[model samples]
Structures are given as C-alpha cells and as structure tokens.
Target: MITVTIYTHQDDITLDQLKADLDSLQSTVEHQVVTIDIDTDETLRKEMHGSTPLIKVGPYTLRPPFNRQDLEVTLRSAQDRVKYYQDDAEYIKRVERGRRVSGADRFSYWFSKQYMLVLNALVLLFVGLPFLAPVMMKQGLTGPARVIYAVYSPLCHQLSFRSWFLFGEQAYYPRELAGIEGVISYEELTQAETIDLNAARRFVGNEMVGYKVAFCQRDIAIYGGIFLFGVIFALTGRKIPGLKWYLWVLFGLVPIGIDGSSQLPSLAKSFFPSWMIIRESTPLLRSVTGLLFGITTAWFMYPMIEETMLETRKILGQKMEVLKQTQKANR
Candidate 1:
C-alpha cells in the first residue's frame, strides 16, 4: 500500500485544499495518510516551509499548489513499481533483507526504551570498581589488583593521602597540607626516602598504612554520587524533569568550579611575585565539590537523555511495526 504523509502547520491556509485533494484520491489510490503538525516542531516547519501541506504518495512527494491530478499520477507510478517488484526474482532476497533490518530496528527501539537499565548497570560497574580493587589487594590477589590500579591511574590521581583504604584503621589519611588535626597525616606514617609527591600518586599502601583503593577520595565521591543518583532515578521510575541549565550551572558547575579553580591560583602563586597570595584546599573540600558535581551532573543530564531516548523509540517503533505488517502481508 502507498503511504501518504501530510505536513501542515496550524496557520497553513492551503491545508484544507490539500486534505480535499487527498480525500478525492482515495478511490484512485490504496494509501494510508498520516498528518504531522509542524507547529510544535520548528525543525519540521523549517524543513517544509516552501512546501507546506507537503504530500507523500508512496515514494513521491508533492509540494503545495498541487491538485489531485498530481497525486493520481504519483500513485499510479508507485503501484506500477510495486507490481514490477512483486514478480521479480530479487523480491524474495529483498524481503529477507528487509526482515533482518526490521528485527534490528525493533531491537534498537527496545534498547532505547530501556536505556536507563544499561545506564544503571554502567554506573554500578563504575562505582563498584574502587571497592573491588581494595578487596582484591587485601585478599592477596596482586595480579588483578595491580591491573585495576594501572587501568584507573590515568583517570585519577589515586594519591594514597587523599584515598580511602578498605581494610584499614582509618578510612582516609589526608596530606599534611590538608590541615586536619585529628586524623593521621601521610607524612607521619611514611618517612621513607624512597617516597615523593609524584610517587604518592602511585602508592597503593602496604599492611602498615593499609591498602588504598584505585581511586582517590574525590573520585570515589564523584562516582558514588552518580551511582546513587542512578539508583534514585530507577526507584523513581525516571519521572524527574530535566534539570534546568541555570540550575545545572548554579549547582553542578559552580561549587566544583570554585573548589577546583581556587586551588589552582594558590599553586601558581610561586610563578608570580612575592605580593601574590594564594590558598590551598583540603581533602574534605575536594570530596564535597566532587560529590556535588557528580550528583548534579547526573540529575541535569539523565532526564534530558530520557527525552532523546523516547523520541528514538517513537521513530524506530513505528518503522518496526510497519515492517512487521509488511512481512505478514507478504507471507
């Protein structure tokens, strides 16, 4: 059967005439008509502005100012094409190929409809890795433990001073510069001449200092917050509205920006004259900022991603349905 797509806006004057032309062609062509309102979608309006009330008769398209005569001609051509292909030897192969494509489309639509399930699984893996690395090391699984640490090294600093330890006395040991009086500092525990600041980033700790995870405290907070948000989203059925850009900037961008950027100027103070004064950040502030960025980023983007996934499902699902009906009719 021929498919007719009518593109129209609410204010389009020629839509009535176009509808009349289509209705007049019903006896002339075996076709299905689908009307799409371009008002709600600016992209559709821009695409069809010169061709308002654009009509599709099978593979043929007719712009505005066209009459029923044009549609009849187009539909006749479409019918002939179908008839020619129906008796062709290549038709079976073509149908089989089309069926395969339709199955792929259906799978694609199903994936889009349940994109959050994939997203949640990814988030779980991401957050779960840090804990796993520590567990592996504690159980004397040094091979996998080293591999995990090596893999995560490029992504994070993994500084022992700023990282949490799984099987340890204290969860965290901040740097001396971090200035927390109560908790043990990195310097007091390790007076080894073999250790330096750069090496600290690679240090995974031993039995005395406790085995550090593959990720640092801030990184842990970041992934943890993202995973936590993913869980909440799943629990809430992902009905949350998209986070506004302004709110994203205020919450997601600002706190992390301030906490991260503020430390830079302090570190660069030596590059300037003596008059330049700068400040340093503590581990607590880093974790807090990282956590805020992670949670807000997920909150801001997840719902917007859902909107895109929904649109994808709509398009692919429609195609899949059409393909299914076509295959059944052909059989």
Candidate 2:
C-alpha cells in the first residue's frame, strides 16, 4: 500500500481540508495517512514552516494551495509508479532503508552530542591517575601505586630527576647539570651516574624523598595543560575560536622543541670537544614548554573537532527526526 505523509503545524487550518480530500479518494487508491506535527521540533519547524500542510504521496510532494484535483492526480501517479516498481530491487532497498533506524545510529546521534563531555572526562581521568600514584604511595598503598606507575611507565620517561615528588622536602629533583640551585640535586642525593638513563629511570624515591609521580614533570604538565584548557573550553560553552596554524607552530611547537633539543646537547656532551658548552633545561622550563605545547595543541585541534562534530550532529539529528516520524507513523 502507498503511504501518504502530511507535515503540518498546529496553526495550519488547511489540514482538515487536505485530509478530507484524501478521504474522498479512499475508494480510488489504497493508501495510509501519517500526520506529523512540525511545530514540535525547531528543525522541523524551520524546514516545513514555509510549506505547512505539506503532503507527500509516495515520492511526489504537494505544497500549499494544492486542491482535490492535485491530490488525486498525485496519488494516482504515485499508485501507478509503485505498482510498476514494487518488485524492483533498488526501489525496494530504498524503501526499506528509509524505514529502518538501527541501534548504532541512535548511539552515533547521542555520541555526536555528548562527545566533548566524554573527552573532558577521559582527559581528567587520564591526567588525574598519575597524581593518584604518588598519593597512593604516600598512604602506603604501594601495590596499587606500583601498578599505576607500571602502566604509565611505557608512556613517559618517569625518570626520578625529571619527575615531581609528593610529600617530599622538594617538589622536584633536577640533575646537577640543570643549574637549579637551593635544593639537593639528583647527583648529590642518589650518587648515581648523571648520564645513566636507566638508573635515573629506576630510582623511585624513598622515605627521605617522597614517592615520584607516575608521570614525569614535563609529561604531567603537558596532560595537565590539556585538562586545564578542556575545562576552560567547556566552561566557555565551546565557542572559542581555533588557534591559527602558524600561531600553534610558533608558540606551541617552537618553545618545546628548543627546550627539548637544547637538553640533547647535554646528553651528547662526551662526543663534543672539551670547549663546547652543553645545556640542560630545568623542571620549570620543561613544565612551561610542555604546558604551552599542550594548551596550544588543544586550542588548535579541539575547535576543529567541534566543527566536525557539529556537522555530524546536524546530519544525525535530521536522520533521528526522520526516524522519529517513521516510528510515530508505524504506531
């Protein structure tokens, strides 16, 4: 049977007349009527408001000022077309696909709307867990704390000299070569070889020096900066403009690159001549550059993601509206 769909607003007075016209043709055509209230949805209202009492007879649409003759002609044409194309594979597929809305579509619609919230929560959890490791160790929960450290070890260098410590006399223990004075240096305290990467990575603090965070100073700062801006972005209702590409390259990439690259000279000092000078970045510089990288990277990327998600929402929302109308008609 052919289906006749009518899209109408509450204030539409021609709806009764349109229905009566369709009812008059009941004996001539086998069809079902589905009336949808466009006023209920803003998007629907915007789309169908200008064409209230819009009638769809199969694939044919009849706009306002259409009379009984117009309805009859359209309906008869739709009936003849359906009769010829009923068994056509492409026609059948299109009809079936239009009527069916799957669970995955519903999920996509929901995720498209709530994606930012999900992202923020995930980043919070990711950035928060590393701090939790030190807290767990402070409370003597070494087993769970070690698990956190182990899980994060692959993601970060986790070197004691490059990590922040909780419940310690000093927040950070830099290498003596870092030129950070007024605190006990890693070389003086641990007596380990300054260039020994493995030894530095293996040293997790003791009672005198509290447990190190699972993430290194720079890594924590980076994720912390991301989480910080995420909160700010959400708080601002996500209307923030995206950072320009060149600005991101200048502010986000350059400082971090310089700070990180400058430190490499210190690592390769043995290969350099005795007169060559080597430099190492202090924790403060590392945190600053890392934070800049994180914030600017998010600033550059999140707004673009928001734009894509907005388009996804628009498309999915339209599909959902169609699905809603279809379900209402079926009932």
Candidate 3:
C-alpha cells in the first residue's frame, strides 16, 4: 500500500481537481491510492489543526501541487524498502545523486551573506545621515546654518525649545530668535547691558548650546546604535568583539534608550552624563563604527569581485585544457 497526502485549510475547485488527479493515477500504480478530504473528516482536521489539506500517503505526506512522477518515485522507493519493488537500490541512488550540492553552487550562499553588509551601509546613508546632521551641527554652527534647519524642517518640527543654537551673540537659541531680541543689531547694545554682562560673566555657567532636536534619548540610541554598529560591521566585516557581536550591540543600545526615554518623561535620570557623552560624541564613535561598516561592505564586495575573477579563470582554464588537447592530437 502506498499513500500520499496534502493539507490545506479549505476545499474548493483546486481540491476537487487534486482528488480527480489522484483517482486517475490508480491505473498507473500497483497500490490502493485515494484522496481523502481532510476538511470532511473532523478528526483529521482537528489532528492537523491550523495545518490543512493534509495529504497522507503511507509513511510520508504529500506536500502540495503534487508531481505524479515524484510521488511515483517515492512510492516505488517505499515499496522497495518492503521488498515489494525489485529495483529499490537503483532508485535510492538516483535520489541521493539529485540531492548532492556542488562546490560551485556555494557561490550564491556567500554572495547573499555579503550583500547584507552593503544593505546596512545604504540604510545608514539614506535614512540616517539627513536626520542626524542637524542634531550634530546645531551646537557647532549658528544662524544661516538655518539651512540645515530648513533641510530638516520637513522631517521634524524644529521647535525652538527642542533645538540647540551655537556661538554668536550669546549662543543664539531658537527661542531667543523668536523673541524681540532676535533681530537686534550689535550697535543697540546698552552700556548698562555691557556692564551687566561684564558683571555676570564670572557667573555664566556652560550653556546648553543646541536645542534638543525633538528626538529624545532612545531615538538617538536605536537609530544611532544601529547606525553605529552598521558602520563597524561594514568596515570590519562585522567581526569586532565589542560592536559586531549582537549582545554587545544590545548592551550599547540600552543606555541610548534608558537615557533618552527616562529623561524625556521627567522620570528618574540615572544614565545621564554617559548618555550626554554618547549623544554628543556619536560622530567620533560612529566614525570608528563607520570604518567597520566600510570594511564589511568592502568584504562583501571583495568576494563578489573575486568570484567573478574565479569564474573567468575557470572558463579560461577549461579553454586552455581544450586547446592543449587539440594541440597534442595535431602533433
């Protein structure tokens, strides 16, 4: 006896055709073959819950769009196992030969892995750089650097309170720019104001230069974390112990989220100075990571290029072999 099965959730025209096909194959095969609708049998349906249209044929289940020849082959092989089919050994050998994976075929496997590195770099440049540039520059450049502000306007609110301003006329923050003093000329400075400034200079603490771009701590960590690791991965081919390993990257992301989220809600802020340090100094850190990203990307590219060269060499070698054979025959 030979059995094959297919499982599906429901029955319809497709199921009807499948059943009809199995009935037609009865004449060609020496065993009792029949199609059982799993949907019709409550017990079968429950037994295969969530997995439908179960095709059960002897020891193996028929998976779907059943190829008659493949089924016949399977059935024959099974029959041989029971001493029912005479040519079982030949059949087994044929199946084994078909399953063999050759050395040349491994090219695609290596190529797929390498391409992932390139994909990570592309995401960093297109999605990351534009979003992060303003945050990075807000503390370094002032006014007319409004260009960076304008560029980012579509993506974010660029709210005054959330933004950071840099040097010139008292690190002009956007909130101050919106107020009356925004357009004031230097000539309007009062002697009293200058006296007060000179007096207050000794007390001036380090000011917050850039408006906190609306992105809180976690946002920086996730985007920046992925960006950071991606860079190192690409540069070093994702081999670094501290950065490339998944656990360390996750560890690094924790502070990014903890610092950003905890402080944003006015909750307990435990991971501060470290958070601030990471946020402000990301460019340098990512620079190291970026080198890694580049390495990873190059690593991917190197193999693609090497394989193309290898393939060319293989073809050339084959041609040389053929030419040498011809020359020997001529001699």
* Winning model by TM-score: 2
Report the number of the highest-lDDT candidate.
2
Model 2, runs deviating above 4 Å? 1-94, 272-277, 329-331
* Cα error, candidate 2, residue 218 (Å): 1.4
Model 2: per-residue Cα lDDT over 15-70, one tens digit each: 88888889999999967787778776555677777888898776799998789999
**What 10-residue stretch in candidate 3 is worst by lDDT?**
197-206
Candidate 2: residue 15 lDDT (0-100): 83
Candidate with more favorable, higher TM-score: 1 or 2: 2
| lDDT tens per residue, model 1, 49-72 | 767877765568778677778878
What clash pairs does model 2 have?
A: none
C-alpha lDDT values of all predictions: 0.75, 0.83, 0.43
- Candidate 3: where is the Cα deviation over 4 Å? 1-111, 129-160, 163-221, 241-250, 264-331
TM-score, predicted candidate 2 vs. hidden true structure: 0.76
For model 3, what is the alpha-carbon lDDT of residue 127?
A: 44
